[model samples]
Target: MKLEPVIGLEIHVQLKTKSKMFCGCSNRGEFEAPNATICPVCTGQPGVLPVINKEAIKMGVLASLALNCKINEHSKFDRKHYFYPDLPKGYQISQFDLPVGEKGFLEIDVPTKEGIRTARVGITRLHMEEDAAKNTHSDDKTATLVDYNRGGTPLAEIVSEPDIKSPQEAKIFLQELRKIMRYLGVSDADMEKGQLRCDANISMREYVEGAAPDENWAIQLNPKTEIKNINSFRAVERALEYEIARQTKHWEETGSPNTVQATRGWDDTKGVTTEQRTKEGSSDYRYFPEPDLPPMELVEIRDKQKEMLPELPRARKYRFMDQYGFSMADAEILTDDPYKAEYTERALSELVSWLLSLPEIEGTETEIWDNYGEKMAKLYSGWFINKLGGIMAQNAIDIRILKITPENFAEFITLVYENKISGPNALKLLELMIGAGGDPSQLLDEHDLGAMKEDKDEMDKIIEKVINEHQVAVSDYKAGKQTAIMFLIGQVMKESKGKANPETAKEMLIEKLEK
Candidate 1:
């Protein structure tokens, strides 16, 4: 029988607030010594009342807005009963009935057989919670160690609906979620650092071979296997793919079993899922309102957070395409990182201002501003995404640490736009500006990398010298050999100490040689 995979994700994002969720302990425990940043509240000492971090709540609301979730004005915390070495209180304080946000959606582009298609994944809830401590077992399995430093860390648990149909879609959804969180400045969402973690609930069902089933039957889904604590997006995709095959085989052999849902852990090294325990239902947690802390009034907070939100990635991407005429692919690349997007915009703005201020020596100022947006978009995207981006990748330098200011980069681009420098010379000047942090024009002059002899008289003299030196090539060019003209142009550029613009020299050579 044909098979269809049903998948959803539960993502825990660590808020980048200064302190823990319910305690004042520092949240920078990832780099500190084991258990160095712990406190009584975090470690769940006797009779210590927990206070909510106002900043964490604000961040959560901001994240909710970014995810397109509806804010719950009165969300209360509940105690989730569980027993584990990582749990100090034997119960985690989280939201049950009332979460901060609900009914949101994230759209991701998936590579389908046809082409790239956009899939909108639904978010069920976005809840605030505290993280459990770390557990490490020894090599001999004789001793287990627990670190409480990460306990009580503020986390926003985003639960998605079963709208994800394939492993690839799931991965893209998570990646988009990470990008949104990062853009919001609420979370770094770095899986390697445990800032963002994912758990996937996946199952397989029959394709319903013939006639449409009844409403009740259509709503029926097979038993789901929850894969716990997948650290990376790729791992989530791999694990889900494996589970779909495994469950499909099992269903073929024994058919769908009506039993308890299973929770399994992914062994990334072995590339398999091991049964951890039966998945617990909501009733199993026995959640109730926390007696210590009162429910929050977040209506005003939500309004404030919505106002504080900067332009998100998707909106900014569409704006780039619509307003600046960037292609979808180019806009995606530019907006993938917040800093790079910001840099691109700043550089474009400065370039436009500079372009409009030009003396109109060659072109009309009206013409420059009329199509300046599209012109600047292409120019900035080409150089920044390809040329400068490639250089940074080769040198392993972060864009944030780049020495060239956006204004200086705009000026450098102007030099190229005006054909004041040759490509090779412009690249040389760019390297100097990036490395030494100086004005592009000044550096160009200091390095003598500009087109040599801007005066037409001087250029004509140099071209005449080249034509005289390469008489055979000049004669060949005059006899209708186009290749010989390029040869003469090369000689002129070399004689000009690599400063002669190839285009200018070629034009000058063609004029003199044709005459």
Candidate 2:
């Protein structure tokens, strides 16, 4: 019997504010020692009250608007009770029912066993919270320690509906969500640096053979289990796959009973999930409204944050096409990566429109063949997306480190248009000149690879000589042998030591022989 999986996600993103939620200490970057980014309030010292950071709210609200969430005009925080080594105050300050935003949805593409599918994941709540400290436990005197530097750091906890049926859906949702966050300046969402954390609960059930729960087709669900401590997208997908298989087997053997609702940690190397402990409910925390901080009224700030919302990817893609006349494929590639988009815009916007207008009016026989115009713009929007931009993003660096200056790349394209070089030769030169100073003239001279095909005067002499020497070729051409002229062009190029431009030589050869 086939089973169905119900999946929901809880994502915690540390906001990219300059300071802690309730203190003036910086929240980003590494600390020199344990508790380096701590203040009296962050360290949970007595007689200290929390001072809310205004910048954190700006980021959260901007992110909410980007996700299409309705911002809560009046929002307050509550205490979540927990006793752990990480919680120095014995509770975490979080928003319980009244969150900063609600009812947001992000659409994601998922690959199912059948085919690709798109799922709209609903955001139940996006609330503000203070982060807990890091804890390392060990048996030996050599190791285990706790770092409180991250404590009291502002974070946004986004809860999503159980609409994601598979791990592929979850992965794509997280990707799109991170893209939104980056565009909004909300958070870095860097998984490797632990700025973004994700947890998910999933359960599988069979299609209910009879009338179901609430008249909906209730797929009979098996005991659901959640895998915790998912730090990477690959891990999320692998752990969910492992959990689905393991849960299915356990149900078939044990007659399908509800496994205890406990949090489990995934062993990535072993590829198995082990039981950690029972999950806690909100009631278990014994929440109460935070008394020190007043409820925030966002009437004044709402409109401002609305203006700060970044254009979403799909919308930006259309704009790229409509405004720049870029192809859909090129626009999608460039806009998906933020740095590339910025680079393209910066390069294109700086150019004068008068320079661009020359490309069409100037005939191909004139300076239009020089690629003096449109070369830089084409590189910015079209070729740079996949070729240059992708390589930089993969290395986790900015566009500045991409080696070649924009001026040099423009020169290379110009050379290609001037028919000074062929496409293959241009690419070969680019590989050599990318990192260092790549002046087209210097490189062409050093490599002796420039197109000599356009020397019509010299190629004409060779073309005439070839026609005279090859009576068979001329006879063949007279007999309508098109291949005979091509043979003569090749002979001229070889005799000129490849300095004769092949294109010009071909035209001259065709003119003489065909005549």
Candidate 3:
């Protein structure tokens, strides 16, 4: 029978705030000691209370807005009861019935086995939660030590419906979500750094042949197993694929025995998942309101956040096309990286005003990458993203980090446009000037790489020497050989130590040979 897979994602996004969710402890990217950043409140000490971080709530709201979610005016936190070594309080403070955001949808275009498929992935809810402590298990697990430093770190959990029909679709949705978060600067979404985590609840369904039964065999969905701790994107894809097959095999083997609803651990090294324990439901945790913390009140910060909000990806793309005469393709490439796009806007400077005034320039700035003026547009775009970007990453460096400012680059472009410098020569000079910050005018003063004027008396002498030295090539030129000119040009460059104006050398040679 043909099979279909049903999938949903429960993604946890770590808020990039300076402190913990309910405490003032620092959340360092990397740390040196165990429980160094933890305090009485976050550690769940008796008689202590949690104070919600205002910034964390605002960050969550901004992400919710970006995802097209409805912000819940009133919401409360509930304790998710569980027992593990990492949990100091035997439960995690998380939202259950009412979350911070709800009823959102994000459209994603994913590729299936057949072709490109667009699906509206429904979001059930987005809630705020505190992270669990880190457990280090290795050669040095003396006394089962735990690092509470990461505990109470604010995390936004986005829950999606089981609209995904395959593992590939789930992965695509994840990647799209990651890119959106990065664009908004809301979170780094770096899975490797434990910034983002996801748990999937997948089941299989029939094609609904004949009629939809009260409950088909497939609809029973064998015990929705929870696969745990997938760290990488590829790992997410692999774990889901493994789980679906494992569960399907279990059902097919023993006449579809009723499988247990249990937790499973993913052994990434072995590429197999093993059952951990029975998965807990809502009542298992004994959730209730915390007396220490008040209901989170979102102060109307629209005025401030709206101002802090930079140009979003789509708006930036439109500006690139409407304002800069960039083709849609160019605009897309330019807007793909937020920092690079910001840099491009800075580089264009007042040229943006000129482009805005002209009708012809209006069509130039589009997000479509149709190769419209592909070469020239790409030159500037690539340099901003690729060349200069590496330099800026070290210590808040700028485009002038390469020693060639936008004005200097513009001046160099002017020289090439005026034909004062040849195209090939200008590129060569740019590479040097960008690194050594050398003067373009003085570049060939001692080098002799430019064209020699015929009006000069010294030009006649150099021409005489070149003609006498390259007799074989001279004979070939006179005999109607076209390549002979290139051969003689190489010779001139060699003898002049790359300091001869190739154009003048060619013209002088041709004139002298004709006589």
User: Residue by residue across 1-515, what tens digits does model 2's lDDT show?
Assistant: 66666788899999988888988888863545787777788878889899889988877787777777889999998889988877888888899888989998887656568865667788888888999988877778677688888898899988987778788888878887877777776777899888889998888776455655344334444445778988899999889998888777876888674556768898888988999988776688999999989999876777998876667876786777766667666776777667667766655443323344555556442244234434544654544654555545666647657666656655565565567875445555666665465686689879886877445676667877888888898888789878877787777766765556667777777777656
* TM, every model: 0.86, 0.78, 0.71
lDDT of 3 by residue, 1-515 (tens): 54456778889999888898988999772564887888888888998878888888887877777667777777778888888888898889898877888898777666557965667888888888999998887786556678898899999999887777778878878877787777778788889998889888766554466654333433645456677888888887898999888767765775553356677888899998887888887788888875566776553743345456655675677677766567665676677666556656655662333334445444534422233334435556554454445445644654424576555554454344335654455556666676677565676454444543434567677778888988999999999998998988777756655545677778878888899
Model 1 residue runs over 4 Å out of place are: 111-116, 208-218, 255-260, 361-375, 453-515
Number of the candidate with higher lDDT, 2 or 3: 2
Residue range 256-278, candidate 1, lDDT tens digits: 73256999999999999999989
Candidate 1 pairs with clashing backbones: none
**Least lDDT summed over 10 consecutive residues: which range in candidate 3?**
364-373
lDDT for model 2, please: 0.74
* Pairs clashing within candidate 2: 452-499, 452-500, 452-501, 453-500, 453-501, 454-501
Clashes of each: 0, 6, 22
Worst 10 residues of 1 by lDDT: 210-219
- Residue 323 error, candidate 1, Å: 1.8
Error of 1 at 436 (Å): 2.2
- Evaluation by lDDT, superior candidate among 1 and 2: 1
Best by TM-score: 1
Our tally of clashes for model 2 stands at: 6
